[model samples]
Target: MIKKSIVFAAFDEEYVATIEFKLAKLTEERASIEFITDAGCLEAFLERPKKIDVLILPYGIMLPHPEAFSKTSIYYLTEEEMDAENPAYIYKYYSVKRMLEKIDSGLITEAESEKGTKVVGVFSASGGTGKTITALTLAHKLMKKGKRVIYISTVPYQDFTYYIDDASVLGTAFCYQCSINIKNALKIIQDEIKNEGFDFLPSFKNLPVSYQMKFSVYSQIVDYLRDKNIYDYIVVELSSELEADKLVFLKNCDWKVLLTTQDKIAVGKLEALLSNMLDFDRNILILCNRYKYNQPDFLSGAQLLQKYEFSEFIEEYNAPLDLEMTKNSQLFDRTILCME
Candidate 1:
């Protein structure tokens, strides 16, 4: 078995260098990666007789003879919105994990029969970081951006009735768990899917039932959704109660958004969470809530995806609050999809 060769060419060494550094440490994949900053260097490398399985280049760097490398998979990197619709172009500025996925961009296309959907796990180390709100808002934002999105809250005891409409599916997810085969699973999921502005699984009847779900069940659900190629993103609200050590299913997600606050205890929890994050250090996006107060000394200079210092906080979850009517609705955009 021959190893695949993956090469990246870009004028900005600093930008591409960061990606190279992250992927190198990510894992020892079955590929040889070379980053070329100079066009002459890339030209000389291309002159080699060795196999070039994949080549990623910026849009401005045109290839004189593209047909020469018929066997090579070429992709263009860009940051502009106009280029997003192109199949050959990938978003240049993205998290390492997301960048890799964009390298295989076919997996996230909306077209059926293609590899589709990205799972975003919204998690927090401490309470009151508004993790659930962030997850629901992410789904809404992605939907508004013309991408298909589904929200799933794995909080166990209750559903996301506060942020979304509570049209019950009458224990559809429970039947899915008991399903024996993929056909049954698909039929059960499709039969019960509810669209509350965006698609979502109601998990259970709109009741205060304590139903504990395993990570394997969630994994199967993700596989089923990806198999259908109907969704662009799956926003999962992971329970913070699972904590850092017990988050065994974290790796299943493509991106993990960890919400935090200026609270001292939250900082300690983040420190613990960051300790075992060797696998997804670059894919973990940190967002601060009530950031007007202050940042913890540890994350003082860290690059945050977004920040909020709301003048008013929703202290109670007993009432259903309409997030679309709130100021935070403007907090999300297509840019929020980017990791790191």
Candidate 2:
């Protein structure tokens, strides 16, 4: 969706910080707010008559030239009084819920909807099932089909970086620092795209385990990319061990692909995981990697359906050790084309 441009004029430092914190909780990509702390800066901005969808002014702030913003939608942030006639006033210390309600209710001008970006997540219950290969090949295939695609590895230790040779990996630390500002994050991503041939956000290998578990930061980075509407598709590679926060991130995705092998242990673990995750049944697709048609199955398809409540098993693809060979083959044809 296109982001609405909002200009907030508040001189108080404490108030500005509170508003910033409130704004960070907003989930929709409807508005992009610009905060002005100095009164002079606000006045100067008003004098120039910038193209802004919403102009938020502090209660009782004197406007030297109110006529200049005649075309702009003006709202007052007041706590003591709310004008009955002009109901465009919001409480200065309103909760984030109320603020979001106001924005969704058309009291605040809404952002236009642009072309939506699709997010696909690839996950597994255990490691070494070719999850990274599936994600990377899907991205390469989508890009080859003339679609803008970015591959993000959210796995711990970021083993996926070794597959993409000669690319400068943007560690999780850099992402956490820059994630506060969407524009700054976009600049970094653009610079990386320019230097590297492909679009990717590398793993956070250098970060401590505690820092790496900040799933909100990871979600913000993905949301920034989606809101920017820069790519047609985003393929996310997740860690095998799915925590509560990781499940929260997976629930936000448009599609979720679960990769598992025919090993009895892997299938057993997957069955246990699926029993607890009944909500994702509709959007989740179970992919059995490295299946041989002639070989007897350790975990049969019927058993998977009966045990895990899966609708059906997706077609299996041969596992190729050579990354280049896999990309050139039809390994990702069914998955990528089906998504489109």
Candidate 3:
């Protein structure tokens, strides 16, 4: 007898969940179920799984950049073929059920080969800078502006929660309630966005420093998002302090922003940081966070723009930084996010 398998390409979150629920109802049966959200997970899963039986694909998965469908048994379910009322879209629900039955009866063996996902990493170069704030702010802004955004911060101290305080937190408790785990955090983010349209995920929590995260894990998360077209923007925040893992993540970001100030030491450090990114297609945009013009000689924003050729990218105007908030609050509620 041929081994049995199940494959699905879920486009939006609702459809993914609907399929998952239907698959769950079949738990009493002996067949094993392997669900894939996007091409990233599909490729990653295919690399490790012993065998594959049924392949279900999201219609939009291969549409963005047609190269995605090169060698996969999966086929498209065009909009005309899909029906909202029918679980299998445009086709009759039982037709899909019968197709699965055929697979279980030693009909289909393996799918044609296909591609993987793309990723965008975000990192910064110094301490006491606004790396986390910038990541959170940009992700939040994108989401509010109607784009799907997945905000992630690899810093273990957990600052993302505060930046998106208005939204319900997806913390340990929430994950437990939903039966989710950190290893699947990226998948969960995909699921949330697929269903809810946008979401955020904190870095792996409660880990001892003895085992720092490998860059591979970060890459996997980035690939998952890219493969699924899960979000319009993927904003990542690394610790302001440098580390091996930090460098790994920075190299992966499509555009790297170096947050800095006019302080002599900070400026010197930033110059050195730029020297390191010489070969990458990364932009070293300078973010002047919590700035104030206290001295007569201090350049106005425009003058700074001319002095610093890259200053044109300065994102927003904000009140001076409050040293107190930086040191005392768990929320790290900066004046910018709090702005009405």
Best by TM-score: 2
Q: lDDT of candidate 3?
A: 0.47
Tell me the deviation in Å of residue 206 in model 2: 2.4
The residue pairs found clashing in candidate 2 are none
> Using lDDT as the measure, what is the rank order of every candidate, best first?
2, 1, 3
What would the TM-score be for candidate 2 when compared with the true structure? 0.57
Residue runs of model 3 more than 4 Å from their true location after superposition: 1-122, 166-198, 203-212, 295-340
Per-residue accuracy of model 3 over 14-97 as CA lDDT, tens digit each: 334334533444332545566666667755654554434445655554333333433434544444335545443322122333
| C-alpha RMSD values across all candidates | 10.4, 20.5, 19.1
Residue-level lDDT of model 2, residues 205-316, one tens digit each, is 4652545345565677788889888888888988887789888888778878778777777888888887777777655656677766666666565355553322123345
Report the C-alpha lDDT of model 1 over 1-340, residue by residue, as the tens digit: 3556788788776455346645664424545678889978877766662468788888766676767778888888775544666667876644555566656533232222235688888888888677776788778767766679898776765546766666575465545453345455556677677887788877555332333345556666777787677888888888777543337566667777777776667766876766656565545666665454333444454333223111122223344345665324435332263432
Quantify all predictions' global Cα lDDT against the true fold.
0.63, 0.67, 0.47
lDDT of 2: 0.67
- Output candidate 3 Cα RMSD: 19.1
Question: Which 10 successive residues of model 2 have the least lDDT summed?
Answer: 306-315
